[model samples]
Target: MEVVVGVDLGGTKISAALVDESGNIVADVRCHTQVEKGREFVIEQLTKTVGELFERAEGLGKRVLAIGIGSPGIIDPDSGVVVKAAVNLPQWEGISLKRIFEERFNVVAFADNDVNVMALGESLFGVAKGLKNVIFIAIGTGIGGGIVVDGKLYHGSTFTAGEIGHMTILPEGPKCACGNYGCLEALASGPSIARRAKEYIAKGVATSLSELVDDEITCEHVAKAASKGDALCRRLLEEAGRYIGVAVASLMNVLNPDCVVIGGGVAQAGEILLTPIRHEVALRAISPAPVLQSLLRENAGEIGAAALAFSKLAEKD
Candidate 1:
């Protein structure tokens, strides 16, 4: 059974796993990103984590074939470099990630935007399996998307093709971190939902959410409140759903993918979120197409990174 190392690099932690061809995780390890220590420290930590995982798998009699890393930023797939990222780690810009891993492990190393890896995983072994031309959108603290065309991930000319979060939804709405106005992320992301709820609470609205937590409310709290029939929280989620639906409708008009799979933390809202999104999609979708729910949800990132490693190993054959 051939195995590969799959690494998911997030703002908070780095998760590495040995994955088999069947998408089974044989062993896994994790460590803090330690972003405050600078780029060199982060790289050293990643290298150590990969090395440890490789050694562990080898000790278990597993032959490691390749390594795949999913990073949160603009990644140049062909060059195996991270162009830019602003979330957790600093100074990751222009880092030759692939070369570092390949030189150290003496094996092929594949790296891509975190979301793209997630999409690849879904296409290969999860919900989008056996399907061509699919869209994977993850709505978490922020929003990100990946496009897979004809069973292959599409990296547009700069290898920054799928930036669904930056899509302008409201021409004159809130300002976004990317210096854009009214982006889908600005309106419907997890932070956006929490912000809206906070505003209502500040305005003296009587909501059950107020009694749940004292300071710094979160999307999870809002979802729980809404589930208990909190009108304000429910409204906030509906509003977010509507915004997400509008964005999906526009994307459908442009790409018309076979399916739009949504994942991430906020997706846990489940029917409360999906119902409104579906309603809006039906109302505004240009082609009146069907919207499919995500199969892998929160696990897409990890599994997708693993799939990418498997893909790289297969390519070498």
Candidate 2:
């Protein structure tokens, strides 16, 4: 059997897996991304992990055909270089990931933004399968999106085309990590949701969330509280959903994809989060054209990354 290796480089961990053409995992491995140790260490970790995965695939009688990597930050897919990354990993900027990996592994290697890889994965195997045009939006510690057009992942000129997170919904609202004000991520991401909830609690809003967790209140906590009828938490989710809806609405007006898949940590909020998003999309989005809708939530990143590798292997044929 032929297999391809997929690596997902995140702020905290590096997960590499050998995936078959059918989107099945033949082998998998993981390692911590010690950010404080700097870029060399992270790259070394990725190298070693990929090598090990290759060996494991060999042991399983699967020939490694290619490799694909999904990483955070702005990537130039044509050049296989990372332009900028905010995950605080050392020396990640301007790294030629594809060249280095291909030379080291003696196989073709492709790299792109993690979210794009996820979207590709979904298009091939998951919820977005059979859809030619789709969007994959992940709401996590940060927000990111991927665009697939005509069955191909669309990496706009700079490979930064699908940065939906940076879309300014409120021009003068809260400060975002990109040094912008009122970007979608600042108002609707996991951290944003948690911060909003905490702000409400600080201002003496009565919420069961206050007593749920002692210290670091998270969006997960808020979702749980809302599930149990905590009015404040529900309201907070609704507010976040509204902001996200506005962003999605804008995307609908622009891309008009067949499906929008929502994933990542915060998506665990499930229907409580999606219901408001759908309602708000209907209300605020440009009318006449139906707004896009989410297909699947959760595991999108992993599955998408794996699918990307599998696709790369298939391309060789």
Candidate 3:
């Protein structure tokens, strides 16, 4: 069976896996990204991780055909270079990731944004399976999104098509890391949600979240508080959900996707967050798509990268 190496390069961690054509993970490994280190060191660590996966694949007698990487920032899929991504990792811009992997492994390599690859994985093998159109939104420290149309991942002219997080959801709300005011990420991301709860706690609103965390509250704390019927936490999450829903509603009207898949850490709030999203979409969108959760968690990027590698390999064949 043909196998490939899939790597998910995030700001915090680097996850690599050997996956078969059927999307089954044969071997997987992860380590801190050490993004504080220079680009050369991070790339070296990625190469070493891929080497380990290759060794494992060879031990299983599987022929490794290609390598695929899912990374953050504005990526040039054609060249497999990061055009610009100085937000999370310093000096990550203009990195020729494709050339590095191809020269080291002596195999075909492909790369794209992390969220885009996650959308590909879900559309092909996860919640949006067999669907030709999908919108994937990941809400964690920040929000990111990906779009798949007609069974292919859609990268806009500048390869920044799936920046759903940067969409201006509130014209005059909180400032986003992207230097935009009132972006969806600023209002509804995990940190944003936590900030809301923290603000409330500071105002002495009297909630269980303050008891859970000593210094600052997190989305997980808010989720747990909501689960325990904390009115403040529940309301905060619901408000965030409404903001997400409004953004998704706009996407639905324009893209007309069959499914919108939600994932990432904040989405663990589940029904508390999903219910409001569904409600707002139903109310605002002309024709709303089904909103679902991601099937794969940490493995989403790995599977999607493997699928991307398989796609690239097929194109060559």
Task: Give me the candidate number with maximum TM-score.
Answer: 3
Against the true structure, what is every candidate's RMSD?
A: 1.7, 2.3, 1.3
Q: Give model 1's TM-score versus the native structure.
A: 0.94
Best-to-worst TM-score order: 3, 1, 2
Best-first order by lDDT: 3, 1, 2
Cα lDDT tens digits for candidate 1, 1-317: 57888888888988888887877778888898888888888889899999998889878999888888899988988888888875676688888778999999998888999999988887787777777778888888999989988877889998888888888989999988889899999998898899889888889999987875646799999999999999998999899888888888888888888777777888888888888888988887877555556676655666688888777666568
What C-alpha lDDT do the candidate models reach, one value each?
0.84, 0.80, 0.90
Greater lDDT among 1 and 3 belongs to 3
Clash pairs of candidate 1?
none
Question: How well does candidate 2 match the true structure in TM-score terms?
Answer: 0.92
How much is the lDDT of residue 50 in candidate 2?
90
TM-score of each: 0.94, 0.92, 0.97
Candidate 3 CA-lDDT value: 0.90
The true-versus-predicted C-alpha distance at residue 225 of model 2, in Å, is: 1.0
Q: Between candidates 2 and 3, which one is better according to TM-score? A: 3
Off by over 4 Å in 3: none
Instruction: Name the candidate, 2 or 3, with the larger lDDT value.
Output: 3
